[model samples]
Target: MNNASSSTPLGAARGIDPDLIAGIIIVLGAGALLTRTSDMPGMTALLPVTMLSALIVLGLLMIGRCLLRRRRRGDPEATAPAPLKVFDNARRFFGIVVAIAAYVAGVALLGFYTTTAVMIPVVAWCFGYRSLKGVLLADLIFTGGIAIIFVVLMGQELPTEFFLR
Candidate 1:
């Protein structure tokens, strides 16, 4: 049956809204995680639960916005969705995946801070961020901030450099 041509019981046209689909998926995934985290003892589950709840809220907002937009348009199926552009830059996408894989490996070999410091700027440049000063500043601030968060605030030890291990 061509549900796209049919009107929903709510009087909205039945058409695929990728954003709505994504939102539903996000909400479901977050809810699932929230349930799993509910088993964690004491305050250990606090952060994950809070974050997951926020994610669910954001996903619901996305769904609501999509529904409202569809209602305002009155006829959603009149125009087909634009073609997904993810594959249009297939090389860049795959390159990033590979780079991330390499970054993960590098973390074990070079330690988290060292690997992250190098990867951030390199990845930024590869993505066509041409400002050298900006990239350097961003890399420093990001790496340093994370280092401070994990090592200082959290009192967690960073992975030791391979040679230092």
Candidate 2:
């Protein structure tokens, strides 16, 4: 009798491997940390370093949890359950990376407001926000609130497009 439970095939046709996903997360997080550490200490550098460290720690914790769960269950394979369908998680993470890249690129070219305006809505939609109105509303609230606090109230100088002069 085959007493072992079959491994859950989570959209294997999409060619997603859990180990690969973990590895990618580890690599990207490490790269971010390295890049940030090489730069002068500033708000920009500090933020990325902090975020990278958090991501690395979170990934490690998740991997450890999967290992522990597998051991506790006495599964012979000891493979962790895939929390997200491989392709979906891949797409989600990639989207986030792309958005971050876009933001960085846009800051100098398009200015803060324009970049953030597009990024906020795009990211929300990527995370399964189906309603266009809801996404737009969320973006407007977030962007507008930040503008009010930083630009109007705090008197901070935000980046502006050259053409606006």
Candidate 3:
């Protein structure tokens, strides 16, 4: 196969844009998040609900951008796909999904801060991050952000481990 064909990412060969597919998936997940949180009191769920709402908006924007790009198909740059680094991006995507499932389930047992702090680095690795510093930085930034938002701002207590309690 020529370089062009080899460079094409997954789903493009069948006329599907992987980005568009991801956007649809993200939107659906966001909708599920909203549905799950709907019954919670607004005061208790304010931050999570707000974050999910933003995710939905971003997902819609992604979908719209993909549609617009497809409509304006004349540009060569737009037509070309990114280089195929992975044999199938699906494996990486699946890994992320599994990791997320575990993280969510872990939160109840491990508590929010600890689960989040640990999961951030694991999820970053699932996304192909290799640098130690990069992963550590991501963990720090995200953990700090969550602490500030949920702990300091919202004044919500994260569940503590049995020993820590």
Model 1: which ten-residue window has the lowest total lDDT? 4-13
Top lDDT prediction, candidate number:
1
Q: Write the per-residue lDDT of candidate 2 for residues 123-150, one digit (tens) a residue.
A: 7777777899988888899889979976
What overall lDDT, based on C-alpha atoms, would model 3 receive against the true structure?
0.75
135 in model 2: Cα distance from truth in Å? 2.7
- TM-score list, all predictions: 0.63, 0.55, 0.68
Ranking of candidates on lDDT, top first: 1, 3, 2
Collision count for each candidate, in order: 0, 0, 0
Deviation of model 2 at 64, angstroms: 1.3
Candidate 1 ranges beyond 4 A from true positions: 1-15, 28-50, 75-110, 158-160
Q: How many backbone clashes does candidate 1 have?
A: 0
RMSD of 2: 5.9
Q: Model 2, residue 8: what's the lDDT?
A: 41
Model 1, 30-90: lDDT tens digits are 9998999967765556667988999999999999998877775565456434333325677
Candidate 2 Cα lDDT to native: 0.67
* Candidate 3 backbone collisions, by pair: none
State in Å the error of residue 39, model 3.
2.1
